[model samples]
Target chain A: MRIALGAVAAVAYAVLLLAPLAVIVYSVSPGAALEIPPSGASLRWYAGLADQPRLISGLFTSLLLGAIATGAALVTGVPAALALTRGSLPGREAFLAVLLSPLSLPGLVLGLGVLTSAAVLANATGIRTAGTLLPLVAAHLLITIPWVVRSVAASLESTDPALEDQARSLGAGPFATLFLVTLPSARAGIVAGAVSAFVISFGNFALSLLLASGRTVTLPVAIYETVDRYQDPTVAAVSTLTIAAAVGAAVLTDRISGPLKTRDSSARSGQPAGPAALEPNR
Target chain B: MDRSRRRVAGLLLLPALLVVAVVAAAPIGLLFRVALYPPGPVAPLTGGPELDSFAGLLGAPYPSVALRTLRLSLLTTVLVTLLGFPVALFLSRSRGLSRRIQTLLIVSPLLMSVVVRAYGWMLILGRQGFVGETLAALSLPRVGLLHTEAAVLLALTESFLPFMILALAASLDRIDPDLLAAARGLGASSARTFFAVVVPLTLPGFVAGASFVLVGSLSAYAIPALLGGSAARTFVMEIYELVTISFDWPTAAAASIVLLLFASALLGGAALLSRRRSARTFGT
Candidate 1:
């Protein structure tokens, strides 16, 4: 009976989780519009996505934004994570909370905050400041950095602080001890955090929705525009590409972090970046 | 080691802190500032006189929108939580290839763009979509699933399920198997062991998962915007439209604040309840 129950659960998950594959099917459907029991199969839509200027540009823009934002997040977040976990700074919890608060707020509010701030800045400066790349990166950095901070912080928590102390006792300077001892030990976490940050930024839409403009559209926003106006399979083709990207990133995360193995360390702790739901009991 | 290192540590955090201040904290402050001011564009430097968006939001469709948001969120929460339980249970118990594949399946949806997933649903749930075709085959007369509360509920539940499942499964995994074995050994039936031993211990997981789902549902814009339609406007939808359509930043700011407060209150209550439970457990 329990086995049957587990099977039922697995089948149910298979159905819900496979929902995205519907896009793949629809993208290839010969029908100009969507059909669940596909009428016929063709690659017409995928062929058309290449010609869609908004989509082509949006793809490039999303990649660029994601790269810059992820770069900013890793550079800042790694150091912040090190200091927070090892530095024993004053008001540590408060600082962590403030930094990670972006993860807590729904992206609607986060993006809107960015939008509002831009409006405020424009108002103050007597300049038209809506829909700029700088705010977009900043907003992405705001949301994406938490992933970096959390993963790196979790790894930092696991690493022995005494390792750094030992290096220091060997007469290494503070900077040398950090570069030599702390950073290398958390290398896996840093790599994992960077991957997570990039993917999170790439997948992010809500923040982009508010920050992106006609010239600076991200893939999600571009897709949003396409779908809002039309129901053709071209959007589905775009979706299929994103779905492929998502799958690749997930596989990458699994491989790079060996996420399942190390999660056992912070599994109980529920590290902020982890999908704690899937962490297995040791 | 102490003074210099501590100072260096503070310096290390400064860049991230500054970005958060400019990006996260200031926008929040601006949300409040312009919300109180007039119903026009903000003047960050030249600040304007206060207006009452809170009072304004209390009137008209804003209240109705808030009500709809709450109803949709509650329904989404209930559905997502129930759906997550089986998945969480499966995840907690499964191992090897089944586990890896299921983990990928469950986690991949979250990484996909909201637009991409929403578009997937668009094709699948549309009147002529697969679900539509399936419904037709079942002899159910044309029941258009798209652009309805039910559709929104379905998609929102899907969107929020990952957060709930992840939280619940992690918590479930932490439980000692011996406790469940002991319950069963003592003649408690499987069901009894589950209810008496499993559910009680995983209350924190339930709270954590439920809160994540609830919060996501409350503020969700993408799934509902795409699947819920213009007619089934959510609170966030109203905020978006207020800015884009009504050209009212003040009202949108106000709406954002009110919605933020509403979500915070609910989350705060959940946190308080969980804390109290923890306190009780520790007190004994």
Candidate 2:
């Protein structure tokens, strides 16, 4: 009975996940206009997507933005996370909360704030920032950095701080212990955080919508405009591709973050795979 | 030199602190400053910051938006928690393929961006969507789920459910099944065992899950914007419009501050709940 129930759940899960993709693919299928069912599917829309250079450009721009934002987040977020988790900073709890506070700010509101602040600065300095790529990237960082910090912080928090202290008691210097022992222990969390940052930045739409100009339009904003202008399945195709990338990142992160330990006994044994596994990195 | 070492720690954290201070805190502070002191019809800013925006928010439309956002988030949190708790419990008990399937169902949606999920729902709930077609097949009147409060509620529930599951699953993992078995041996039925043994044990996770969904729903933007229509206006939506469309900086800042305060309160409540659960568990 449990197995049967599990099967039902799995089927429902697959349908919920794959249904939208099926709709998009079917909508663009050849002979789809035939009354009851399409006789054949075609790759016409996939081919057509290539011809739209603007969309192709948007994909490139989005990739570039995701890269930049993830880099910025790692630079700022990882160190902050390490400090908060390890260092006995004053008011650490309050500091941690404030650092992670952006998580509770809606992306639209965050985007609005970024835009308004940029505009205020630009008007003050007679410089343009409203329709620039840098500002959009900056906005993405605002949202993505929190996930990076949170993930890394979790890993850092759970780790036995005594390990570093022990390493220091031996012959190792503080920096050496940090680089070798502390960082290695937090490696899994760092990787997970980085993956999240990448996906969060990549899939972001609100910031891009408000901030992107003709030159800086990312794929999500592109899809938004395309769908508004035309009810084409091509937009769906783009969305499918983006969603696929997101799922890929998520699954990879899950695998990297280590196996699910729904049971306490299972969690103890589900240690992260090391270099030898060559498994999907979180 | 030892003093310098301590300074090095501070120095190591300077860049991040600066970024947060400039980007996050400044905007929020600026938002409050602007909101309190709405710009004049001509100059945009005349005197010091005032409470006009706060006062304005207490009036009809803004208050209604705030209430609606709260109502939707509260409903979503409740629904997601109820469904999520059972699923998490099942996951904690299962193994192998069953566990994998459960994990996939729970985490797959988290993989999708809020925008894509919104788009998926748009396809599923739109006028010519699958739900409409299915209703037609049953000869039932098709209700439009899109561009309504229901759409917003459903989308928020879908997007936020995964977080609840994650939190609940984490907490459930901490509970010892032997305790449940022990309860069962004492003649407790399944329901009684669950309530008597499992629920109290996993209460921390339940609170964590509730808070995750609550805070998540409170801050969600794409779901509300994509699924809701004019009537389903949320506070976040108001803040966005004030900044982007109207360029009313003060009012936008005011709206943001209001949101910030409300979110802080909600999160604080969640934290307190988690702490209380842990304390209760330890006390027992």
Candidate 3:
């Protein structure tokens, strides 16, 4: 009875998650409208991607943007997360909340806020700054900082602080202790955080819509422009590749974060993958 | 000694603090000031600013747009919770290989960018899309949901449901098996065991899951903008339109403040609910 019930649930969930993806992937036909069990199949649409140099360049732009954003997030968010999680700072909870405030604002509001601030600065300083990468990176940093902080904080909170004390007693200085002892413990989380941050920054659409200029189009923005102009399978082909890259990152992160606690009877029953395994990461 | 210790900790945090100040805090502060400092019908900063832009939001088109955004998010949150609960339950109970496979399967959409997922949905929900053809094949009067609010709702639900499921599964995973076994051993039917023991224990997960969907759906821009169409503009879409198309910075800033307030309220409410739940669980 339980097996049957689980089967039913699995099927339902899989169908829900995959229906749109399957239909789109299967229905890509050259010069034909999308249909499930498409009357014909052609990789012509996939081949068509090469014709759009803008999208190819946009893909590179997205990777570069994502990398920059992730680097910024890790550098900034890690120390802050460490301070909040490990240090005996007063009002740390309040500080944590403030740090995470960006997560509470929609990307549109964040984009608008960043844009307004950039304009204000530009006007005040008498500089032309609307189309620069500085604001775009800054805006994405806001979007990704919360993710790195939260994940690193989670790993820190769960770790034994005594280990750090032990490392210090063994004569490791603060910097050495941090690099050798503290960071290694938080490696999985930091990596997971980095991967998710990159995904979040890369997949981001709204902020790019506002912040990206003609010279700086991200993959998401390019997809939107392409789909808007021509409702064809070309967009699907692009989307398919985007999905492939993202899924690869997710699967790779899943492995790097470690396997589910299999072969342990005591830990057997619960969600095989813990919170870190399934975090939206955005 | 205490001051020095505090200073070192502060030093460690300074870089991140500076980044946050410039990135999150300054922008939001600037947004408020810009919104509040609406220029009069003259050169900039000539007259003392008033809350006219905020007052402008109380006008006709704004209210409907605000209402639609909330309505879509609310409906999506509820639907995701309903659909996510069972999958989460099934996921938490199963073991080993099946569990990992199920985990990957459920989160596949989550791996895709919002733009990619939205594009995929556009293909499936369009007039000549699969759903429309399937309905036609069944001889049901042809129905096209794309370019409508329904399409946006479907997209949001799909986008946010994985978050809900993950949260619920995490919470459900923590539920003590002994407690469940006790309920079942007491001659309780499976349904009774589920409700009497499982539901109450999983309430925390349920709340967390609901909060995830609520916040996620509320903050989403891509799903609505991509799937919702021109007429079905969301708060984000409206804000985009306001700044880009209309070139109304002051009003756009004001509108953004309103949307931020709305999103914050949802987060605040979720935080409050979770706090209360934890208090009930832990406090005597």
The candidate maximizing TM-score is 1
Query: Which residue runs does candidate 3 get wrong by more than 4 Å?
Result: A1-8, A19-28, A35-40, A260-282, B1-6, B37-48, B133-142, B184-189
Q: Which prediction has more favorable lDDT, 2 or 3?
A: 3
Count of backbone clashes, every candidate in sequence: 3, 5, 0
Clashes by residue pair, model 2: A256-A282, B31-B253, B34-B250, B36-B50, B39-B44
lDDT of 2 by residue, A55-142 (tens): 7888888899989988999898888887777665667777666766666665666665676678678879988876678788777777
Candidate 2, residues B1-284, lDDT tens digits: the string is: 55654466566567776776777777666666667675423227557657876777777678778888889989998878766666565666677776655665666556555666677777677765667756766778876688899988877776666666666666676767688788889899998987787777767767766765776677666677777858588887776676557766676677777777777787689888878777776885
Give the distance in Å from residue A149's predicted Cα in candidate 2 to where it truly belongs. 3.0
Among these predictions, the greatest lDDT belongs to 1
lDDT of 1 at B213: 76
Residue-level error in angstroms, candidate 2, position A44? 1.7
Candidate 1 structure quality by residue, lDDT tens digits, A55-89: 88998999999999999999899989988998779
Q: Which residue pairs does candidate 1 place in steric collision?
A: A36-B130, A277-B166, B36-B51
**Prediction 3 TM-score vs. true:** 0.90
Superposed on the true interface residues, model 1 gives a C-alpha RMSD in angstroms of 4.1
